[model samples]
Target: MTLHEDACRVLKEWRAPDGAQARLRDTYLAHLDAYGDGVWRSRREGHITASALVADPARRRVLLTLHPKVGLWLQTGGHCEPGDATLADAALREAVEESGIAGLELLPEPVWLDRHDVRCGGPDAWSVHFDVEYLAVAAPDAAERISAESLDLRWFPYDALPDRTDDAVRALVARAAAALG
Candidate 1:
């Protein structure tokens, strides 16, 4: 099946944690139906992005990247590529690419859905990212390397995430911690 088809199935099967999440799921499904491959990039007015909150095997820490554009300490993720087989694959690939960590395994289900605006350099001054977030467990003793996409990468203890992080990020971490337990 195509990535679009896989995404449709994944969203349909997903059991959202709240009414807000359920609404986001429905919006994502509608976006997929309307945009197809365009939903994967900023080429459209808004697109779907996949991200992951990566935790250590002990679930004590999460890896976050300092996004150059947004200047926020955020989870690893980005636009979906043609090589991606599913949204989960896209999230996992971003985690590995951004964190430079091996043996990261994503939780079978998504942990969060978020929609936010992003500024684009091109004619379109802005775009929206319908972000699907998953929880991934990194290998114990995993080492991290920062890529060009990020100004910095670090592992923060679940209770001590950076102050600059927003409430959504903190909530994701809390949910991930509970899932680990």
Candidate 2:
């Protein structure tokens, strides 16, 4: 089987019976604009995800999402849609919609940048390449609700993330943290 097919099989087998995994499947399919298919290679189509490195200057914490599919801590973001003119605006919209914190201001400049492939979840026909853009600032309020797309949302200290999360996520956090400094 191709790597894409193998990853899909593994995701199917390893997925939990919890209803949340179904949300991942549905969300992936619903957001088809993020992916594309080829004969032998599945590739992540260009997409936008708005990420906020919400740093509480007083508390010195960064907001992060406990993502449902990847099952790892990550910044809040989602696939861009026709409604969004630029990827940065889409990032801000996703962050606010998911976090429910208003009065957020995107940093004048992107703090960090990176890319990753969508390897698993939904159909394993293609990849979604996320051109992740990082924005920084304090959250509007502590009262925030986790969206359906995320299992949980909370803040973490820069030093504590490596021990508390996966390596890939840790790396992204580190990238954002360095830019924050």
| Candidate with best TM-score | 1
Q: After superposition, how far is residue 90 of candidate 2 from its true place, in Å?
A: 0.7
> Candidate 1: where are CA atoms >4 Å away?
57-59, 121-124
Worst 10 residues of 1 by lDDT: 35-44
lDDT computed for candidate 2: 0.56
Taking the tens digit of each residue's C-alpha lDDT, what string does model 1 give over 23-119? 9899989888888675468556888889999899474889999988877899999888989988899999999999998889899889988888887
Candidate 1, 76: how far from true, in Å? 0.2
What's the number of clashes in each of the models?
A: 0, 5
TM-score to true structure, per model: 0.93, 0.65
What lDDT is obtained when candidate 1 is compared to the true structure?
0.87
lDDT of 2 by residue, 27-89 (tens): 433343234321122233433344565555456567788877767777777665546554456
